[model samples]
Target chain A: MFLIVGIFIIIGLGFNLLGAFSLYRFPDVYTRLHGATKCTTFGTLFTMFAVVAYSLGRLVSTGEARFAVFIIHGAVAALVLLITNATGAHAIARAAHRSGTLPARAVVDRLEEKEEAKGGTPR
Target chain B: MTIYIFLFAAALVGLLAVAVLGRLVAGPTIADRAVALDTMNTLVVGLMMILAAVYDSVVMVDIAIVYAGLSFVGTMFIARFIEGEV
Candidate 1:
């Protein structure tokens, strides 16, 4: 039980750390959003999984109902994180684009091109 | 032993959140700062969930859920502000 829980925690911390580092490593907003959003979401998912696993192990060993409550609540928090993180990222990206922040060193900007094709001025 | 692991993980995650703050302070553009803030919010949620396990409190997990929802709304408002819609 300790090994399973430990592995999940380590994996989560690793990814979370990577996400933080990416904020400094990426040069622009869009790229940073890509790294920070995806990595942190994945890391948090693993952390939640670890918590659920721990609760399940305890529930099985001690037959406690509180551990079941822990499991369900932890799962709900994870679901909320998963859904909100993605939507927030999309909102941020769209806002950034509309607010006149262009991607740094891009080969092609399909969104800008598409907007131009529709006769809308690219910001 | 198990408690030590949870505590250590929580501490490390908190450290990562602080590290992300560097970008929040130094980001050259509003969009960059917004992205950093969003990342920090996610980290905080993760930290709350871990702390819930450390303290053996289901109520902490419930708080995490509420915090996540509130932060999402805050992020949306920031996004709208950036778009000049508000």
Candidate 2:
């Protein structure tokens, strides 16, 4: 049990740190958003999965109902977070694009004035 | 055994933190900063869950859930503001 708990903690922390690092290393808004969403999502998944594994291990080892509750609740929370984070990242990316934060390395401006000029999309 | 796993995970987290910090400090635009903040929020929730496991308490996990929800709201609000839809 102790070993399981330790494993979970370490995994969780790794996920957390990687998520933060993505914020620093990504170059443009779109790329940064991409990194933030993907890495953090994966990190969160690993951390929460670790928690579930630890809790389940404890329940099996000790036959405690509390451990079961912990697992269920933790899983639920992780699910909610996963759904919300993905959608939120998308919203931010769309907003960023609409507000004029173009890709730093982009060679094309089609999403900018060209779309509106051709009457292909609403401004 | 578990202790070794935790140590390894924590080490990875530390490395990720260093990389993310590099972006936060040098992000070229406002949107990039916002994105960084969003990622940080997710990371914090993960950290909270790890703390819960470390202490053998369920409270930390609960807090992580709440934190994740609230941060989602925050990210949406900021996105709206940026979109000028607020």
Candidate 3:
């Protein structure tokens, strides 16, 4: 049980660190959003999985009902994190584009092209 | 033993949050800062979950859930302001 929890935490830490580093390494808002959102979300998923596994093991060993409650609450928090992170990232990206922050060194901007085709100026 | 691991992980995540703050400070545009803020919120949620395990408190996890919801709302408000929709 210890080994399993340790492995999950190691992986989560690595991915979380990568997400932080990406914020510095990426050149623009879009790329930074891509790295920060996907990596940190995945990392948090693994961390929550570790917590669930730990709680399950405890619940089974001690047969304590509180451990079960811990598991349920942790799972709910993880679900909320997953849903909100994605929606927040989408909002930030759309706002960035609409606010005139273009992707760095892009060959094609489909959104801009579509707006142009629709006879609306790209902001 | 397991509690120590949880504490260590929480500390490492806190460090990562500090690292992300550099971007929040140095970002050239408002959008980049917004992205950094969103990342910071996610990291804080993860940190809270790990700390909940360390302290053996379910209430900590509940707080994490509420924090996530409130941060999402804050992000949406910032995004709308950036888009000139508010």
lDDT of 2 by residue, A1-123 (tens): 665556555555555555565565656777767767887788678778877887788789999898998998888888988899889988888888888776778777766777578775463
Sorted on lDDT, best first, the list reads 1, 3, 2
Superpose all Cα atoms of candidate 3 onto the true structure and report the RMSD in Å to 1 decimal.
1.0
Model 2 over residues B1-86: C-alpha lDDT tens digits? 67456546655654564566555676676667677777777766776676677677888788888988898898889888888888
In what order do the candidates fall by TM-score, top score first?
Answer: 3, 1, 2
Classified by CAPRI criteria, candidate 3 counts as high
* Pairs that collide, model 1: none
DockQ, Cα level, model 3: 0.89
Docking class of 1: high
The two-chain DockQ for each candidate, comma-separated, is 0.90, 0.56, 0.89
| Shift of residue A76 alpha carbon in model 1, Å | 0.8
Off by over 4 Å in 2: A1-19, A107-110, A118-123, B1-22
Cα lDDT tens digits, model 3, B1-86, are 88888889999999999888898898999999999999999999999999888788999999999999999999999999999999
Scored on chain A only, each candidate's TM-score is 0.93, 0.79, 0.94
The DockQ score of candidate 1 comes to 0.90
